[model samples]
Target: MKIFTPIIINGLAVKNRTVMAPMCMYSAQEDGFVSQFHRVHYPTRAYGGIGLIIQEATAIEPRGRITDHDLGIWSDEHGLGLKELVSMVHMAGGKMAIQLAHAGRKSRNTFEPIVSSCNQRFNDKYDIPKQLSISEIKDIVAAFKQGAKRAKEAGYDGIEIHGAHGYLINQFLSPFTNKRDDEYGGSLEKRTRFLLEILTAVREVWRGPLWVRLSADEYIEQGHRLEDTLKVIDLIKHLIDAVNVSSGGISPSVPKVFPGYQLAFSAAIREKGLLTFGGGLINSIEEAEQALAKEKADLIYFGRPLLLRPFIVLEAAKTYAPELVIPQYERG
Candidate 1:
């Protein structure tokens, strides 16, 4: 089926349309280094025949971590473990990418003052983050550049800028969170400036496939809508390879989600001439095939299912597209 077809993005060829979405494992050490768990967890999925494995939300700095245990690429020392992880994934016959992220106001594990576009708390339970100064913003941008450099040095196939899920980048993009009167706020173009600058910096050092994951719809009354994200994509589409479309993390209100709920957002972004990876609650090969066949998204990202069954892609291939199954696993 079309789900098993090979596709190319920014010169990087993936074996199939099945992608492993970046899911925070919260399994790293306090120093943000990869532990034994990650060493085994990622390669297992790679061996399972996933086309691309986007590693979890790795912090660009200590303060950016979502939890004390989130994986990181903030320093050179962190590269050693990640480099080894990348090698294992490559050996397992899968392409790998890493998501560079900062938790912003949502940062919960650090004692250092959390900084965001504006001084707002994600919720009553979370601490109010300090507003970032212009110079500090520049520093964060440089940090992202360094993160990209580390990813390249670690042999990552690609890098994904985590602009989604109410992180630092998403905070800037959403009006509800970004209440600044400065250049990084107000207009849509202004709100997207942080991400654009990050992409610009990352592109300078990393000449590989780059993806941006965006909270396409904030799922709130005054949050960023599909049209707003289209404008953001239009502004920076030329710099990145593709977009991983996901939604609703800017607020506490949970979106009414179902199978293929985010596909429409992906389709909308795809219509704007941007390649997109999208899927939510997608569990069956038929669902994946239907999404790809309908031209909703260029790739399908399996999250929870992959976590529960590491070899899900292999199982699907064995049942529906036997020719795509790995030869060694054929006997099974």
Candidate 2:
């Protein structure tokens, strides 16, 4: 059987198992508006035969942006430009999704980043983010909702809350960054309360497909573990439609491998009966097929490979299932 088979999430139908992973292009204008670069950069992959295309990590609030150059959906102005990008993907015959994110302690304000809790000398360049007051936390939640709303209005098929990579959401979910004592801190349940709250609120605004990107484990001790993710998945099984499995932080340096090194995590989520997307080192047709045959993941995501080969999915489909035909333009 081919790995590229139809899978359904909520009401959205993914045409194949191959997904185009969200990558940071940092090509947005200073005002956080999508440019021609964002439009042409994304839709072409879908045209090349990707089943799903996730927009880059978009900051929910101004302070939440990793770089001033990162994409944002905090306001309607952003939605205006994003509408064009989303439309391009759909017109190319692919499903589109957005990754709503906030860079908590990880804010790359080389100009002035913000931290959620206390400073640990990691704030030489980026401004130390003040510990969010009860009120500030509420505002942040609202920002997620606003971001979700904009994504929907912009015509995206779904939204993926970016809770991995030690960003704002991940910081609170992991034990290493969040040090609060209020309802938002201490104990795994309390630490997890923040992510659930955001998910609950975003769910209210976005009625379509809902997905979450989670770090299976930060790959660090005292940080989030597979058990932590499983616990959250248990709670989210009802609210979420799918879970995208990923790991590492903004600064990642892992040993190089062929592809599908992280399939085990997706398999864990799959055990829960919730649809899962496997990312990280996913590169060839054979690897993609093995992921499905072994039940490691339901969907496979491609990242860096898209930049090197725009029509990789089409090529892979031909290799894995030679009976499939390729368009004349895609052959070259």
Q: Estimate the TM-score of every prediction.
A: 0.98, 0.93
For each candidate in the order shown, give its overall lDDT on alpha carbons. Answer: 0.93, 0.81
Q: Write the per-residue lDDT of candidate 2 for residues 1-332, one digit (tens) a residue.
A: 45667888889998888888888888999857898898898888887888899989998887778888999888889999999988898888789999999887777745554757444323455556778777888888989988988898899998999988778888787777777888988887888787888889988988799989998877767677788889878876778888999986723434344467778888998899888999787777677778888889888898998988988877766666544434555454
| Most TM-score-accurate candidate | 1
For model 1, what is the error of residue 326's alpha carbon versus the real structure, in angstroms, after optimal superposition?
2.5
Candidate topping lDDT: 1
lDDT string, candidate 1, 1-332, tens digits:
99889999889999999999999999998799999999899999998989999999999999999989999888899999999999999999999999999999999986577989998798899988999999999999999999999999999998999999999999998999888999999998999999999999999999899989998999888898999889999999889889999999999989888999999999999998878999999997689999999999999999999988999888888887888777888987
Whole-model alpha-carbon lDDT for candidate 1: 0.93
